[model samples]
Target: MSKTKESIFDYQLFKRLFEYIKPYKGVFMGLIVLVVLLAIFSSATPYITKDAIDDSITNKDTKNFLFYMVLMLGVLVLQTVFQLLFIYYAAWLGQNLVMDVRVKLFDHLLKFKMKYYDNSSVGVLITRAVTDMERIADIFGQGLFMIVRDLLTMAVVFAVMVYINVKLSLIVFAMLPILLYATRVFQKYMKKAFEEVRTEVSNLNSFVQERLTGMKILQLFTRETVEYEKFKTINERHKKGWLKTVWYNSIFFPIADLASSVTIGLVAWYGGLNVVFDGTNVSQGDLVAFIMFVPMLFRPLRQIADKFNTLQMGMVAATRVFKVLDTTSQIDDHGLIEADGFKGEIKFNNVYFNYVEDEDVLKGISFNVNVGETVAIVGATGAGKSTIINLLNRFYEIKGGTISIDGVDIKEVTLASLRTQIAVVLQDVFLFADTIMSNITLNHPEISEEQVYQAAKDIGIHDFIMSLPNGYHYNVKERGAMLSSGQRQLISFLRAYVTNPSILVLDEATSSVDSYSEQLIQNATDKITKGRTSIVIAHRLATVKKADNIIVMDAGEIVEQGTHNELLSKENGYYKNLYEVQFLQEEAV
Candidate 1:
């Protein structure tokens, strides 16, 4: 099923976004003050020019003219200085606000259950974290300042024009309503266009990210051309979306420019007639001042319209970001029991689970693993073996029944405490782009170099690691791409061992390794599982032959269960067939 898209301009979303900036109110208010002062200084400049032209230059008044000119220059310099100060402060506040929101969003995402990630794409989430936050920052930094400054400039210009010549000012101001109405209409259209553009951009980002991350798979399957064609199609759609936004903006600007021109032309014709015929209150200086103020008046209105478009885009991005932040994880740590430690007696009593409603994955599954026991689960893909492990780890909560550890229901235990007691080594091992030493001692942050070496030695990868140029300090590239598959799995094994977990989960941990590395990992597994409850989900039947008990699962039900020899005696049992097939394969090898 597809997820629903949400609107960004929802009032609740804006209210929530506003809350992020609330903490930096002092900086925000100071920026506003600076913007207002800058606008006033900018608007007053034209009057200074008019004064020098009409009174000083025209009338040949040299005494105070120089003083006035110097004063005007100082005001211009002051405005420039304050403008820089405000821009800096606005950028700082905006960046800090983005950081706060991004951190909160990331924290909330981490708390989400595995199901959320299963349903959402990694690319979309990453776009929200990066591109979306940048959009919001742009709005907060420049878009917001533009709005405030423009409005202030417009107001000051209107007030000055009326004070100079009310009759001519009224004629010029007659077009204000028309300009405002046009802006309102354009803003509405631009907002919708921007929202569409943001959505398409998100889709484009997701497509590119997915393709790049899966480039190896695409190349392996010889689907490079096919994927390229698909990417081209998405890119074309993004272009179309951007073009639509540009089309609207293109129309908006021209119409705005025309309106402003008409307003200025009408003001000039009427004011000129009054100066020529009636010799009214309007002066040549007043006319020049009005013309200068005309652009100032329409310039801000035009800017407001343009900035509105940007603000809309930012709102769209914010909506996407807030969607993730607002999501309430179904599995919460609330009302959980806290414990100092855990004893590894696990029970799954009549447990039922489903990733989606009405589609049961695990049907009334029940099992028990005693303390310090090795239990092997053998099954084909999608037979619910991994689902059981996931449920045990509380990655996905069971819809029905109870999973308990040492007589305490896992749901009643704190998630951190419950997870702290368990360590997992999966087939697809993930190593961060860091040194091998860091990967092993991930759970124990303060682990010493000696402990890291001991853990690596236990996993039987110490000699190979030491042979590397930098030994334990050798950089593991993204996803451990620099290392061989077997080597990466060995590091994961060492990591799991270092945790000293009460329960160790090995889900095809050695499946990717070669025979030699598999044997080494298997030997390390023996030491790691000593005195701990262990669950091994192995595809290679030989890997779990030494398990204390083996549970054979088929279609989400345990069909057979016994020791290796006992299961082999049942000729028609699933385990026997699996064991025979693996044995034949090994013999062939």
Candidate 2:
């Protein structure tokens, strides 16, 4: 069955969401008390009418009429007071609850294994943390306590109607079965409609976020018209989902209003005959009060059906939010061992990995790098060169064999311990729209301003950064778009350098830089790689020739391993061919 046809409210999902409320139990329970009080005072107003008509108006007693008027006004004042308190406290609790849930969600996402991110969309995760969070807040803000107040008011109205006159109450209640059936049908199908709405909302978020993030590519390929058409189709489906709810509302509410009107007609017919013709227990006072009570009772019943939709939509949001919270894809940090000051010795023993099952991106690859060694890996595209660096950092778990750091299996060391010692500078560097200093230090208080300036000077970009408007404080804007490709590479190198990692990874991205930046990049590379266990995934002959060792990868396996002259000594070695091709490309540049 489709998600819409599935069980409307997952009670299990609700119970899990409600667990977040326990931290503020005092405030939550206080709101419930306020709702109950609000219902009591509001329900009392109808019964006030009966006593005023019977004891004062019917008897023509002036003193009794005066007292009932005062009493009626007092009930209204109390109802208004309790209602104000109910609205304020419920909203306060709702905002607090969602705040706590959003924080927990972001924290959970931070520790998730890279494998989880590999398969998940950035837009869907954003929708879960943002849009879905607000909807869950509605569960408390406008949904639960309001439903409680309405139902309690209805219950009191029902009891008062019966107490005033049973036969007349029975006459009114005969119309109830029809109204109740309509409400049941409305809740069931409205939930299904909302389910569709929520699904479409997620799809729209994913599509829009992806398109906007890659807007440059979309424009470059001139696919704007084609993408716009696809968006309209998705958006139209979303429109239909919402209009389906509108269609249900147009049908169900009128049925509810008809039911209420029909009950009032029945009460007037039955109670009038008894009072006028029979002159029995149903008095003029009771007849007058029933008219007031009929609307009071039916109003909440209709509202409860409407509020039931609010509850349905909240549960749908909760289900999606909790699905992410329930995911077990977080990187296992069970190891207790901490990485301390040590030599940088790394090994991959018969390592095998794949992004998908049995696809084998790394096929039993084995290699070793000793302390303070500089190794370069060279390969054509899809040769699993980057996969080795990923496994070393434990970003992904290998399917077979063991990866060790300093002779200890990496699985036995804590993730922070293992990761803090390694720094990687990728081809496509990512920076927040912040100052250069903040991007380099990432706002770490331990790495003060002096340390940052020193690192920048060490890497020879201090002068370039000083030339910008605010120097180190200059805003690079989104993804360092304000700077050139070479500048971004230098900032990444400075970022990786300040950490003083035991192992440095330089994914040589010198393929697209001007001559001036190329010389600066080469100088920065020399400084950062100088006394560290460095691994360079080479795309340039300068980096490959300087390496103490070069490992050639081809189609998920290491094809050859040796120094530059040694690999060149082989007549048909993989590294020799790769180096020659890369050299020709640079010569053309």
Candidate 3:
């Protein structure tokens, strides 16, 4: 994923994150109440101790001392209860918020245009959806809630200390400005370090994912050592990124600790002198209570600084997540026309398209296929054959002309209805790491096992499926790695047929299949295209000789269109030349 420099406080991002928490406001409010109660209980403990020491212990009133002791124990128990409630509810709220975020992000990705995925990394997307979400959860579960809790405790402790002995309280707070300055500097450096660390983590994940996905290619080319060296460099950068954060942690916390220690020492020294020498104002119990109050005040201050890191990192992660969620590069689906009863009459009128800016792949192309007609487009690589199929399906919108089905522009129909009516099988078939049956039905409960078997039987690949270790129950293992390319292609054919689409598309679908699988695919193709409009994009001229129309393309323009025999009859036609060249190549092979 790409990133821009971000500020430490992204107010907009934080505001967006809080929207997820809105659904759980009642629980959040409960947490806030618990935090305030916990603070009150905590602050009361030191004062209770002061009273016990000065009024009960020193005076030697046995019954009253015992009474205060039990009262102190009860306060501690209540404090523990509130602490436990805060932890539990804070975690509950965080988990629910992360779940909402992850679901929303995934839903957004599903709607993004093909161009976005073309330019993005799978691993980086995974990091944002999974790992970054976990960090966001930590903000509420461990970071934000705890920071608030500590701050409340400290503030309550401070007010009580001032009430007990205002002069001593002033002396204890004298080191606060220095510690605050150190914390500010620490935050600035740590934010930069953590941002770098996040970037490195995304990079490392992307590198590992790509390398592993292409490990077979790497091994075939004997590039393992080079790849490993590259991984080490990435790993080193990742380590260095984290180390920078650790360095800041090492510097920041100790400075906070030292300031805390100095404050404690000063409070004890001044309060102790007033108790022993001056004896006019401060009591022994007041000095004791202030000493106890010092840690409560300074410890939270130090922890607030620590917890701020969590808050900052979550904010950064949230910003990245929101950037993706806010992306506008999704396929436009403004068409209100429902694609019910589509007749599958596809026509492209002088279409122009480009995958990249100002570089047209298909130029001034015009063609039409009537309902139930089979049209084959044959062209050399990069001659705009596949681009036509892509445009017809509205995978990429054409720049200059209209693509229509049943005389209604495709862009005028709802995408879901349009895409659902069309089925496409490309040269490379992708399968998930799931059981064959699940892959076939896509776990759609409406598609029964019987329907799948019938589709496979009709396609004549049922026996091939049975030959597998567990037939339909067998796991394909990521990207169908466990299956041969031919087997995967057969599966793809079965999948397309099962959808019972109105218009079928085969873009060199049999190119990867073996001769035996090719025969089966040809048979399946015939059965599926029997009464539906189908477009076949093929390189092998022989396979397309039986097509209803053979359209020849050259340099992004349609050069010839006719039945195979008619095209071949033209003495110097491009189709005739292409067919002869392919026929010779086949003979040579």
Candidate 4:
């Protein structure tokens, strides 16, 4: 499912594109009818001119001349009406089609595992969801619909010319092969150019998105000038990609224009000769009509070449979008366990896992937490503390292991039901840019405003929320930037509490907060963990002192487990040594 290597006229791509149009078949059929009528009406104009000149003007019949003028006006009026209908309806169909595509793409994105996001660039995904969809929309609004209309116009124009005078028609068509060959060359080169242009667009998107999101870090490190130079490199690459497309267009259109001009010139030269020669069978009216029809024929061919680029760009976009849609990176959700109203005993039976292939983060780890037990896991950096929490949530598939809750393997339950029973609060809390109430309740219609208020009250953070300017309606802004870290942590506590999950996880939630906030969070934690199964991950030795059991981990394996005082009593033990260091450091501060 990497980027697609596609051609200019990909029949298979177009066949897939047509599937999206199937839902609007009625409107598509109507658009087809309008195209045929437009071509017919356009072709009628030249024939009317022929009649007005040969039968009305030349024969001195003013009545017939006036009648043909009225007929031409009627033909123009019909063309205008159908043209308007086609333009408006084509846009409508394109909008609906893009809407469906964008929604489908976003839904597919939601099902992907964390591994997919870990490897993907945010900017490239944004371009696929937004810019690429627009390109696909143009396939309908400007490319395919106009291509059909233009081809029909050429067909009708050629048919009328042959009927009027086959010899003159043959004379004009003599230069078509040269023009067709030029167009073919144009399509081949432009397709490659357009692909490069899209690649550069994705590159630029990735560069800008990363730089902007990390602007604070860039400023703090005073790396602005260095980063600017880096952006210039990417910008140059993007510029060159587009310039290649412009260069292609600059060469292509002139060749097409010259071929069109040469065809018109040849038609004029030979058609004029036939009108003047003594033995010529072609009439002046027929010659004039054939001359007019030359542009009608070549102009559409030129337009088709132009619209073909549009079609090609859309096909490239479709290929990228469909690749994502066809991805098999989603976690299997067919597990049948309901995961409701059960004892919350969790066990990790010889689990082995890694975020990256062949690099084990957790190696043959096993642990058991009985129902309603509070077990604190204390570990050094990269000792697989957070990895344990991620595994419990099934954010990743373990390489080899069985994680069970209440004697049932976690993988035997549906993901939704499994996740509904566990709530996680991490040290790096994330809050959407929304009202305080929405951040607390996540806009879950089932969690009412009164329930949110009561949860905050139970956690003893209700007064703090009411102290804000908008109370529950206060906007946290992006990433809760407007609030202090402790305030954000308290909001996370309320969020987890309101969920009422049977199993609770607090992963270093107290690591970064101030002493005052730590006390408040500890109070909240005591209330919530009273009757539930809890697994707390902490780096600070003092925070887990009151746990029912403490597990000391180093190098991805548990070295000791006992009550806090029992572990502290062992001479030269890892937990005892670590606890003494942290306790002395806090005492010194």
Give the worst 10-residue stretch by lDDT in candidate 2.
2-11
Model 2, 1-589: lDDT tens digits are 7654477556777788788899999988888888778777776877788888888898999998999899999989888888888888888888899999999999999988899998998888998999989988888888888888899988888888888889888987888888888988898999989989999999999999999999999999999999999999999999999999999999999998998898898888888888889867788889988999888888888998888888898888888888888898877788888997548888989999999997999999999998988999988899999988888888888999999888988989999878888899988899999999999999987899899899889989899889999999999999899999988988899999998888998898887888888888999999989978999999888888889899999999999999999999999777767657767677676
lDDT of each: 0.83, 0.88, 0.86, 0.87
TM-score of each: 0.95, 0.97, 0.97, 0.96
> Candidate 1 — which residues are off by over 4 angstroms?
1-12, 276-278
- Model 1, span 31-108: residue lDDT tens: 888988987887788898778777887688997689778988999899889988988888898799999989988888
Candidate 3 per-residue C-alpha lDDT over 103-141 given as tens digits, one digit per residue, 9 for 90 to 100: 999999988877798899999999999989999998999
After superposition on all C-alphas, the RMSD of every candidate to the true structure, in Å, is: 2.6, 1.7, 2.0, 1.9
Better of 1 and 3 by TM-score: 3
Off by over 4 Å in 4: 1-6, 277-280
Pull out the clashing pairs in model 1.
Answer: 337-412
